[model samples]
Target: MFITKSINTFGSYLMLMGKVFARPERMRSFFKQYTKEMSQLGVDSIGIVLLISFFIGAVICIQIKLNIQTPWMPRFVTGYTTREIMLLEFSSSIMCLILAGKVGSNIASELGTMRVTQQIDALEIMGVNSANFLILPKIAALVTMIPFLVTFSIAAGIIGAYATGWFANVINPEDLTYGLQYSFTEWFVWCGIIKSLFFAFIIASVSSFYGYTVEGGSIEVGKSSTNAVVHSSILILFSDLILTQLLTE
Candidate 1:
């Protein structure tokens, strides 16, 4: 019974998403919302993303260099590994995790507050499509911004890894460049970008669903916000696994 209900709920959610995409008014509202969310997700979050990406890049490079210190180890392995990881996983997956904490939480809180305050209800009463008006914008914004954010993350990761390699003398500047050039794969980068797009959709939809469904008072709103982040994060992880498997296969 529980499984059946869950399936039904998921089906309904998909239907709603379809409808959202079909509506012109919702599309317009989504564009407006997209602009606002793009600023928050891309521009405002840049500092944190850069900091985290840099540290992650440095740590991974250092660790790989230390572990594979054999004389037979290729000089370019460090740079190649770093680039591969950044292009394939770090840029998309790790950045999405950060976004879950930032954009996901914000979406949940905003929608939860509106739901608790009866603003959503008021909009419904006024004959507005609350779901289309509120949720579509968030989904649109995230889908638009995540790809760009992933690009930024990839660039930051590469720079960070390069700096660490230079400082540690693991690879000379020319070798580093060669490794990076040799490691470049358009397919890996494209895969990461696709993953980012899927992640954006999952985060926006899950968070908004929690917020839009909120009931009761302030306490319930808070609960919804927490639930939104928790569930969205879980879903993101699950989706990531599935996407990885599919893409790699």
Candidate 2:
């Protein structure tokens, strides 16, 4: 039974991907949905991202300074460290983890509630393709917005680092500026952007899958929401590790 269930789940995933790619009509609807989700995922999340990024940058910069004491501890190392952490891990991996908790759970619960209320079945009867209509837009929106969000996150993190350097007096303002200027690299930025796109897909698809497959009553909806967040978070972490290995090596 367990093996059979696993196969069925895997088959469902393949079918979902196939449907997403093969149907032109569905793609149009998905695009429309994407616009709506963009507002929710990108615009709505800006404040939180800003707040988190600021503190993260400051804390990381301070911590790095505290740990290193050699004359060879280049002033530019601060900026390089910030850029490396933000580009490789913070913007992509950590943001997804936050989204999995906030956005993923929300998507699952909303869809699950619709399912329990028979709204999903109503859509089906009305000839609406639930996956294409509901899920696709979210996927599209995430793919489109995550890179932009990462950019904001990177900027905010840098500002935070600057604030810490100025306030703590561990590094001179000119030195911090020099570090930031010296560490700037296009490849690191590109890697972060790519990771953001991948994370967007993972969060949207996983959340939508849980929501679409929801059954039972309100209780089940709650369970599905929890599952969606937990599972999506795990997948994001695993994918980050894989991508890091591939990209860094």
Candidate 3:
């Protein structure tokens, strides 16, 4: 019964997502909402993303320094390896997974509140296409902003590596710069961008799905929010694996 019910719910969620992409009744309304969501999801999130990414790069640099003691091995390789890690996954996949927790819950709770309060029903009664109005803007904003966030995270991580390695005497500036440029692959950068887009959709769609289907009041809203974060995180990791396979191999 549980599996059956889960499958049914998944089916319903897929249908709702399809409806979200339908033509908006008012492009102006959607555009306004899109800008608002972009600010909320991207600009507001910059500080936290940078802070975390910096720490990630710093730690990677230290780890590389501590592990390699051979004279034959160049110290600058740490910077290059750090760059590869950040570009390949740390900046994009990991950052989006974190945002899944932050942004996904926010989206779910907002929509769940509207659902329990009947705001969505009222919108339908007023002939407003609620899904297109409320959800499409969010998805659109995320699709655009997340790639930018991924870029920010990459820069932040690189900056972090440079700062920590230079100040701590762990690696010289020239070596770090050389390492950063070592075998840099454009394919890795493209893979990160693709992962960011896929993760953005997963977060927005899953969050809104749980919220839009909520059946009760405040307690259910909270539950929906929690479920949104959990489901989105899981799906992001799963999709990351699939995307990495397809994009890389």
Cα displacement (Å) at residue 5, model 1:
5.2
Tell me the tens digit of each residue's lDDT in model 1 across 150-239: 888888887887887578775566766777888476988889999989988888888888777777888888887787778778888898
Candidate 3's C-alpha runs over 4 A off are none
Clashing pairs in 2: 34-137
Q: What does candidate 1 score in Cα RMSD to the true structure?
A: 2.2
Per-candidate TM-scores read 0.90, 0.91, 0.96
Stretches off by above 4 angstroms in model 1 are 1-5, 15-19, 26-30, 168-171
For candidate 3, the lDDT comes to: 0.89
lDDT of candidate 3 at residue 19, scale 0 to 100: 85
CA lDDT of each candidate? 0.80, 0.81, 0.89
How close to the true structure is residue 237 of candidate 3, measured as C-alpha lDDT? 89
lDDT of 3 by residue, 175-210 (tens): 889999988889899899998999999999999999
Candidate 2 per-residue C-alpha lDDT over 1-249 given as tens digits, one digit per residue, 9 for 90 to 100: 999987897788668766655454555666666778999877888888888998898888888777863578777787667767877789778977997888898889888998899998998898877667777777888788888888989889888998986787866768777877784678878888887788888888888788878989989999999988988898888988888787767
Could you tell me how far off, in angstroms, the CA of residue 167 lies in candidate 1 after the best superposition?
4.0
> Best TM-score goes to which candidate?
3
Pairs that collide in candidate 3 are none
